[model samples]
Target: MILRIAMIGFGNVGQEFASMLLARREWLLKDRGLDAEVLAIYTKSRGALLSKRALDLGKCLELVRGGRNLSEYGPESTSLSPVELISKCNADVLIELSPLNIESGQPAIDHIVAGIENGMDVVTANKGPVAFAYKRLRNLARSKGIHFRFEGTVMDGTPIFNLVEKTLQGCEVLGLEGILNSTSNYVLTEMTSGKTVEQAVRAAQKGGFAEADPSLDLEGWDAAAKITALANVLMDADTTPKSVDRQGIGGIEAKDIERASSLNKKYKLIARAEAAGEGIRLSVRPEMIGPDSTFWSVDGTSSALTIRTDLMGDLTILETNPRVTQTAYAVFSDILSVLESIRAGTAH
Candidate 1:
């Protein structure tokens, strides 16, 4: 089977996924009997590339890595927007790796809609769409009969959504609790060691774990989005990040960290979603936990989630100090799953 891919948002994660796709090309063909080709790559500022034939992902990665614009490729470059390119490019899968828009899920939702409407399977690492409009997009995909998968939106490559969908069959997810934001966790962990909040944030940025504008992570918007996404999909809690009662790590001081440590506790930004009446309540707050807590040992870029279910009681998943490659693997794994569904004639 040959899968043609069109990607919107070719940023750090996109570039890294492209590299992984290149490296695993042979493995995909030989093991999975799948031949995948990247046909279109769209970026907000960098430039866009679209082709009827497979675009040279190697050259694209090289150019972007060398700090050159994708337009340097010359002929294959196009001026079309992502949605326009989606209509033109004959792709089997659409990959969305756009940056998170905490305010509203914009162009990312638009991009995914275009893909599903164009009769393409959609995969995304962006949490905005799921957090804001999961039900709408999911209904659209179901009506259009296409696979919509988003495993990388939270917990890096860790299988949260897939675990429920594939393994925990018939289990009702009652609630969710997690340390979802790596940047916040890293910052708090540093602060426990006597570093100031500002110093910890700067260190996180330098380590490439936090965005240049770490406000999203520091202000709790990132965790809010992640928790909202989890609730929307797993528990059918139709909501957005705005609905989350949130507090960030910004309120933590050097003294606060010291207090927690003196009490034999560690501060972590926890995201929780639980049943409330007929709906769900979502919250992100910094809470100090002692060694007995599952999240106590989950420090420094590590993320952990606990799922409360009817049959399973409680289940937890963890990913430690994930980097870009894990996120790339999320995309890769989703693509292969799509291919399997396609082969089985069950892509819907």
Candidate 2:
């Protein structure tokens, strides 16, 4: 079965995913017996290009790398929005790789909703929808009998969600705590080495670990969004980034880092969500952890999530120096999972 995919964003992760898909095309066909094709590529800057036939992935990559519009590839470009593309595109899966709008979860959420309503499976790396409207989107997907997977929303491609869903069955997740934001972790790690916050953040930006506007990472909103998504999925709680008690590392000075280091502790921007009295407690804050803690040794752009379960004790998953490819691999993983579900007649 050829899985026709309509990608709704042509940003960094989107381009990487497209490249990886093309690079692994033969392997995907010969080994997994899964024939996948990108049918359309849409971007806010370049407009939308749709082909009923399989799109030329190499050409798409070339056009994107050359800073040329996707519309130049022979398909008549439509000024249609992402929601319009999702509604009208003849594709099996709608891959939402757009930039996150933490405030409203827009455009990405709208795209996913339209995709599911229009009878297409949905996959996304955008954390906005899951952080702000998980239950609504999730229930809509179930009602429409489609798949909605966002494995890249959390720890990039570290398989946090997959671990909870595929493994750890019959065990209850009591709590989860870890470093979810790589940019913050990277900055903090650099700061511990005598670098100032601005200097460390500059390094992160230069390395593509931090965005141009680092407010999301420095202000703790990114980690909050991630933990909110985790809580909604694993704990069955409805929460948003605004609801999480967040404290960023932006205010931490060099002296603070020095103090923590002298005290034999490291400051990490930790995102924690756990079962509270009658509800789930979520927080993203910079906490000083000692050497004995699982997250204390997690340095650089690495991320670690420790899940405390009733039966399995504490299981910690660490992802070291995650880049755009890791996140793109998460989307690819979701695509394969969707294919497997289709083959097994369990896509819903």
Candidate 3:
């Protein structure tokens, strides 16, 4: 069975995912017995392209590298929004890689809904929809009998969600604490070395870890969104970034960093969500952790999550250095999961 895929965004993560798919095509077909094709691609600035036939990914890469739009490709090209493409494209899966809008989960939320309603499985790297509307989308997918997976929402393709779902079976998740934002973590690590917050943020931006407008990362909105996503999925609660109490690293001073160092501790931006009575309590704050703490050793652009469970006790997962490729790999892993479910005759 050929799984036709429609990509909703053409940015850095999208480009990396497409390239990895092409590079691993033969291996996927031969070892995994899975065949897939890219049917359509829709970009914000580059227009859209759709075809009933399989799209030439190599040609798509060429077009992207040359700084050309999809409209310049062929007759099938047209300037359609992501919603239009999702409604019209004859694809088995919809890959949503668009920019996240936590304020109002637009375009991405609408696109995912359209795909599920049209009888297609949805995979997304965007966190807005999951953070704001997980229960609604999950219920919609359940009623439609399709899978909705967002493995890249939290830790740039870390297996947090999958580990909870697949590995931690029969164990109840009581609570979770994590360093969810790489940009903020990088800034704090740099600050510990005597660099000012501005210098650290600039270094992060140059390293491609922080965005040009990093208000979300610096103001704790990014980590808040991630923790909200985690709470919705693991704790089965509905929450948003605004609902999560947030505190960023911008307020940390050189004296504060030095004080932590003097006490043999490190300041880290930690996002925590725990089961409180019937609801979940969430907060993102800068905390000084001692050497014995699981997060104290996590430095640089790395992330760590410690899940408190009933049967399994405390489980800590760490990603030493996560990058774009790891996030792309997360998307790829989700696709393979969809395919495996179908192969097992479980996918609806």
Top lDDT: which candidate number? 1
Candidate 2, position 206, lDDT: 94
Q: Across residues 1-348, which tens digit of lDDT does each residue of candidate 2 receive?
A: 688899999889999999999889999999998788888789888657877788888888888889998888885467777787777778999999999998989978888888998889999999999999999999999988899999999888789888988898888988989999999999999998888888988998899779899999999999999999998988888988999999999889999989998999999999999888999999999999998988878999999999989999999999988888988999999999888887888854
Model 2: which residue pairs collide?
none
Candidate 1 collision pairs: none
Backbone clashes in each candidate structure, one number apiece? 0, 0, 0
RMSD of each: 1.0, 1.1, 1.1
What is candidate 3's CA lDDT for residue 321?
81
| Candidate 2: stretches off by over 4 Å | none
lDDT, each prediction: 0.92, 0.89, 0.90
Q: What is candidate 3's lDDT per residue for 230-335, written digit by digit as tens?
A: 9899988787878898898889999999999999999999999987787899999999999999887899999999999999999998998888998899999999
lDDT of 1 by residue, 29-143 (tens): 9999888999999988888998888888999988888888899986989999889999999898999999889999887999999999999999999999999999999999999
Q: Which is superior by TM-score, 1 or 2? A: 1
| TM-score of each candidate structure, all chains considered together | 0.98, 0.98, 0.98
Compute the lDDT of residue 94 as modeled in candidate 1: 98
